[model samples]
Target: MSDNVLNQLRNKRNRPTVEPRQDALVPKVQPEPQTEEQNSPQETSPVPATDNPTATPADTIAELQAELEKYPETRRHSAIVLEKDLDQELTRFCKDRGITVEVFLEAAWTFANADNALLEKITTEAKRRYDQRKRVGQIKRLITMLSNSAK
Candidate 1:
């Protein structure tokens, strides 16, 4: 893009500039207490096409939220607090990177939900490290004893 176009784009919005915030706007993990019914996936039937622009606040909160909860019985819905500047930056970043936040979130959810045997892996690693330390201590003692005898 030409400098003139870039300048125009930048000046197109006369909104007051917000100070850069330090904290990245990310989705906060809010684990809700799960009930039995909430463990099932809600079967959201396909909604037919409509000529409504989803970009605006014209859609009711309840209506938009309803679109989020598909299998409410299987999983819980999380409410997010979005900081406006952070949200805009994140959106631009995603667009620039050609990344789908939903896909990444889904993959993350799948990994988190899977039985990854994390505890077992941690335990095995701890034991291995402990054994290595013990061996190193023994080797140090052996070297000290041999060196003293040689001296």
Candidate 2:
């Protein structure tokens, strides 16, 4: 083979490959620069880095809510379990309703976030007398709302 052809083949073999992207398109909008006097927390959002452990849960949640407002939707971490038949069934159940388990759960979490007392009540089992299945169904509806809200 010619040296030029061999060089071309070698370069092709050494080319770096990009991983298959599953992320939805994110807009290229940039945040405006803050002025010297605009450093107040109320005036400008203080987005903490992911590695900043000092960032409270409320801070993180607020950031997520802001992101949701801007793009209306964003990709998130997900998994596929090959061995868990029940998990597969749950995924299918959500998919059949035009949603994913992540979306369904996110909606439920958002609804729960609206009421701080709800978490305490659930943990304390204050409403233990309530029908378990009924509560589960209610959570499902919340998930649907959350999924729809993102869309």
Candidate 3:
């Protein structure tokens, strides 16, 4: 090849090319300065007392009555005093024994109303001593019998 033609080809290969400017590729976003209110601490409004409401006493009583209606007539008429822990325990105990609180109360009333025939038969202290003596005699008899049988 000619020297001029070779030099021209070499120059074309070695020379740096300028690329077109890309103004459309960049996104334009301006930083906005924070206002005084935005920079300050936010003030939250207090929750209104009326926002979270509860059922009234009348409404609650009605709801309880509705639940009671789902029960049997006997159970509906049952008087349950849920004031004390003992009452609650008694209710649970009655439920465990497959007896209603009403039936248990009725039995208790009947027992209380019954004549004190047993009480009249023995004095309180005499009854205690009699029971103690009876237990002690039985133990003594059991020990004597065991000793004799061993011999």
Winner by TM-score: 2
Candidate 1 structure quality by residue, lDDT tens digits, 23-103: 222222345778987998756535433334332334444555777776444454575434478678767877887885554
User: Model 3 Cα displacement at 120 (Å)?
Assistant: 14
Report the number of clashing residue pairs per model.
10, 0, 0
Candidate 1, number of clashes = 10
In order, what lDDT does every prediction score?
0.63, 0.69, 0.67
Model 1, residue 104: distance off in Å is: 25
The residue-by-residue lDDT of candidate 3 on 1-151, one tens digit each, is 6999999998889977799873332322335577876887656536322221354545556766887999867535644435378788988999999998778876865775575764454456557867887898899999999999999
lDDT of 2 by residue, 1-151 (tens): 6999999989989978899963222222346688999877764335433544445566667766887898665675667433368688888999899997877878977887788898677656635634665787799999999999999
Q: Under the 3 Å rule for N, CA and C atoms, how many clashes does model 2 have? A: 0
What does candidate 3 score on TM? 0.25
Model 1: clashing residue pairs?
38-73, 39-73, 39-74, 40-73, 40-74, 41-71, 41-74, 42-70, 42-71, 42-72
Q: What is the lDDT of residue 38 in candidate 2?
A: 88
TM-scores, each model vs. reference: 0.24, 0.28, 0.25
Off by over 4 Å in 2: 1-69, 72-75, 78-86, 121-151
Q: Who is ahead in TM-score, 1 or 2?
A: 2
Superposed by TM-score, candidate 2 places the C-alpha of residue 78 at a distance from the truth, in angstroms, of 6.2
The candidate maximizing lDDT is: 2
